[model samples]
Target: MAEKIRLKVKCHACGYVMEGTSKYGKGNYHPEGLDFQFTAVGKLVDKAGNSRVKGEVTILCPNCETRNRFDI
Candidate 1:
């Protein structure tokens, strides 16, 4: 059985809160609360021709439509 972890994030612009759950090994992560969207920004290419996304992410807040950026 995999472990379940609780996740929470706060909006820096409006003080809104969001919650979610993720499985340790299953990689089934889902967020619940105000409607929001996230996009992975920036990319890095390795010498092996493999591309990996950066840890930085841009989140659009549904409450105020403010775009918040953070490094995860």
Candidate 2:
């Protein structure tokens, strides 16, 4: 069975919830902040426990902190 996960990012300016799909990517990403692009690849394992290039990652965001929040 495949596991489930979720990522929650809050806006610094307005605390707007920035939710995204959490596809399993190894290690910590954006530790230094969201001022750059992040790429990572991990080893894959089959049902029989074999090894392969798992996948890669790309974080796409608006990076617009100024307008991330809205008033009700």
Best prediction by lDDT: 1
Residue 30 local lDDT, model 2 = 33
Query: Candidate 2: misplaced stretches above 4 Å?
Result: 1-4, 25-72
RMSD in order of candidates: 7.1, 11.1
TM for candidate 2 is 0.29
Q: Which model scores highest in TM-score?
A: 1
lDDT of 1: 0.54
Off by over 4 Å in 1: 1-7, 20-54
Local distance difference test values of all predictions, in order: 0.54, 0.41
Residues 1-72 of candidate 1: C-alpha lDDT, one tens digit per residue:
444434367779898775654333333334444333333445568999965444444567768877776664
**TM-score of structure candidate 1:** 0.42
In model 1, the Cα lDDT at residue 64 comes to 85
Error of 1 at 16 (Å): 0.5
